[model samples]
Target: MDEESRNGGPDSRQFDVSGAKINILSDEYDPTVSLISSNEKWVEDDEVPRKEVGTSSFWQATSNTVALLLGTGMLALPYAVMLGGWSSLALLAFFAIMFCYTGCLLGSCMKENPLLTTYQEIAGSALGLRGRILFTIFFYVEVLANRVGFLISVGDNLARIFPGVESHIPAWIHLSPSMTLASLAMLLISPTALIRDLSNIAYLSFGGIVTSLVVVGAVAWTGTTVVGFNQPIPFANFGKWRFILGLYSYCYAGHPVVPNIHSSMREPSKFPVMLMLSFTIATTTYAGIGLMGASMFGKETLSQITLNIPRDLMAATIVLWTTVLTPLTKFPLAVAPIATELESFLPFDSHSTAHYVFGNIIRLGILGLILAVTITFPYFGSTLNFIGSSITIITCIILPCVFDLVLHWRTIPKLQLMVDIVFLTAATCFAIVGTFSSGGV
Candidate 1:
């Protein structure tokens, strides 16, 4: 290949894909020069630097990473375990470890070539232009669907909180609990979505973490006390384990964003430490919340653990409010990527008034479509399953392992290659089986 094609030219930006740095010079194709040179633009435009004066400290990065990992997924764990049984914990543990490992692989790719900023960029690097396009398509579909799921979640919680309102609202108004909450959510998110700077909404990301903690804490306490854990502690039946494993895997759906998070770290080498700490905390919390809810409520455990709890007004209010507010805060951040990508295609100066006006209109239109989807088909489980089977597995497991092997084929040890093959095969199988089990396929 010509130098320009190999190095990605001047416009080519690289971010760290692998957690560890790779010495690409030894290879027939030298990736180091292009990777390093292209990173300059990304470093300048990255959200982290715009949000703050400098790269984030370990703790700051940790907080954000943890917040990203901990979310509405926690609420569904109990139901996952209820379906997969206790065996699901083993699957959860396995997936968590693999998730972190694959994350490290992405990090290593970044380390080798710190310029690769987005998942799409990394995919492009690994599999060339085709890979980039494929990843972007999946990324858009997965995230849009996820956003719809978030709307559904917010609406569901709101319905629970105000069960009476749904009854009172006229049928002619077509204001079911789901529709009403989704409409309100879209309204709340529109203004935030219009803004160009993601840094402005940094504070809102914490809402997911705070709300998650409250829900987990409430579930743990209530599970032990009011519910009186009469259900089996380590309940296991392998029959429907695939279904449960799929949901559990869905909980660790933070891999796509890891490179961005890693790039923002002040100490990039320590990114693995940050990854482990965040995953450990998130996984433990998920386990505790899921197990407790399942042990207490048993077969009765609902998709959201809070729903199964003895209805104390205060608890219900707090849980439900957080559910709404958490996603409320996350809506902008979640949709920002989509808006940014869509905005890029418009032929207008980003700084121009026309751009801002048009951008917001497009963003609102996107949100309107998502809201419509939620209203039309408000099934959260199917969305979760689809994401888990498709993007989650591809981004988290298959792509990472495959990229590592492909990028460093000659240098990496045979044993490591074998392991990657095993993991890739197994994870692919899981994705397929999980999809079928979850009725996604």
Candidate 2:
């Protein structure tokens, strides 16, 4: 498809492509009506005078990317190693490298079409409306799943920090300690989700990075000085390879938000560098904590490494608190794109009073749904595994390569084409195996 066809027609008004408004027509026409009516038209006109709304600097973008990649999933890496064996570290490394490459592929896809501001838009541009819908379902579900996982993690770590808190609950309240803590966390996080600009939350993202480092340091200290790494780590265990692959896939589940981060960058061209730095830092942290926690606890490791830390130790308290903080900072970032997309479907202009009120309502509604899910099926590891296997593989690995190939098939080099096909096939296989394994099918 040509640029006009891919983006929509020349006169259509698109939504959420950019924050700034472009008033091509005079004061006679109602932009809101046109926006609501032609929201499906995704094209940007070259002739229209438009302004870019991106304001994030290189470091801020890098920080957001890092925070997005290294979420509650990091806590599960050691447990993942426990399942797949020590040799699974190689699989972790492979995913880290491949996801970084695929993330760059997303950037490339965005570069080819500047109007493509969301992951769904990238799919829509490549494979049309059906592709966009397919990706939208997977991407939104993945974001919601991540939010649920975050609340579950917050609850898990908080219970670790304050043991026996569950006993204090009144008989009438009918809530577990983890559920209560997660409810409180949801209340605190709901406000941040209302912020429209990614740049505004960059500091929170930086805070997440700091808290992650502290968690990693705490794990290292516990392993080296407290627990001692004497447990034997096997070379390989093919039995749980499916689940292991899903866990590794979960670590790099940041691609859905990549376009938003790229669009928010002051220097979008440096996105590849941002991806490199973000992935490098995240991979190192994952590897360090996974190796240390697995070698220290082995078969005894809990789903969350924070849970494995000795509760009696002061360091465990500090680490648990930091782990609690990590997800609070990340929940907003993960849900931002979903909120933006939901807001677009509303019958109002972007950033208007109606939009603001309804946008907050949408975000709060999303949090409510997440809270309900967290309270109901509070299985952290299973939730992450299902999300990674069933949805994340499609969003992070398969779709980027598919979009790249579809958009640049004729011009793409033969070598790159072959590589994309290989990635597509492998990711498909991994998704099938991991999904069935998670479902016990």
Candidate 3:
């Protein structure tokens, strides 16, 4: 049963925040409470208890975030190798440090301000509401585009393997239509329903992690046979470490989800450990698969390439469909929040939850935009690099630390600013290089 049907009324929970009853409601329990002034903060006043952080569990959270990213992009890992060769691992290590650093800083902010749900809230706290909304919107736009590309790319691999139902339809129609339908169906469902609790889906994450290991293991076994350990390395402007850093940045963009995960964590301090483990797992996962792909396919074949390098159709199809499953699940959940936020201007009566969910055509419209972007910008590698680098640099890397330093400038020690300056400087360099390299210059 849904939260409404189960509770039979608005579900809420009261937290004593400075002697005020902060009644948080909804099945999703994502508190909509916002501070209007020092004397007033608005929270929904329903009789129902607040839903616990069940859907965003540590294992599942770790797995889903890692899996969705690893699936589509890890397929492109070989291309990174193709671009800069084995030495690229140096840049990868550098990014690992930065990833953990940013994750820790973001986590600290979340711990300090537990109510800060959106990165927009974090930004808005210092940069004003408009700035917060703009950055959040820009970040969401990139995420949506990336999600679309992920589905299309998965379809591309599936097409290479399945070929067709009857093997009679034209390539363009056959490919795009089926994938679009699959994406649409996934989006139309309520993520709130699919995962009422994370523990319910914890098995899915464990299953996904095992599947990833099996798939990558299979690839490693095959790739090792063909290319061995000593594959040819490229010298594509070796001096351009900045662009290389940008490429590595794309492979590790799950830092934003840290806040969502931290909110659920039993011992939030363990969050840094979890985040690091997640990144390490992701890095090793992608590097292994990328190495396998490059060993088997070489630079020319692997660039803008996919996971369809398998000779066995059955194996390839299974990997293609299953690898993208988590990303497919993430699409609707991520999109719903955007739609809900647009609820304020929605031309409908204020009190209809059904209308808010169903009446909005804007969600479908956003999906259409995603499809258009994937078709027009068919080259996935550079597009992924550029978007991932630029947006993540701003949203994940630069923004939080900047906000912390700026808003709490006087309270913060001088050492903190120096550290942020170094990171910001590094990120700027990476963004510049990533943009140019993505342009094929």
RMSD of each: 7.3, 7.4, 8.0
Q: What is the alpha-carbon lDDT of model 1 when measured against the actual structure?
A: 0.70
Error of 3 at 302 (Å): 2.1
User: lDDT by residue for model 3 over 366-412, one digit each (tens)?
Assistant: 56566666666655666677775777666667776787776767877
For all predicted structures, in order, the TM-scores are: 0.82, 0.77, 0.73
lDDT agreement with native, every candidate: 0.70, 0.75, 0.56
Candidate 2 per-residue C-alpha lDDT over 284-366 given as tens digits, one digit per residue, 9 for 90 to 100: 88988888889999999888988998899988988888888866776666666566666768898875899889989998888
lDDT of 3 at 252: 69
Pairs that collide, model 3: 10-48, 11-48, 12-48, 12-49, 12-50, 54-198, 55-198
List the candidates ranked by TM-score, beginning with the highest. Answer: 1, 2, 3
Candidate no. 1 TM-score: 0.82
Candidate 1 residue-pair clash tally: 20
User: What is the Å distance of residue 414 in model 3 from its true position?
Assistant: 3.8
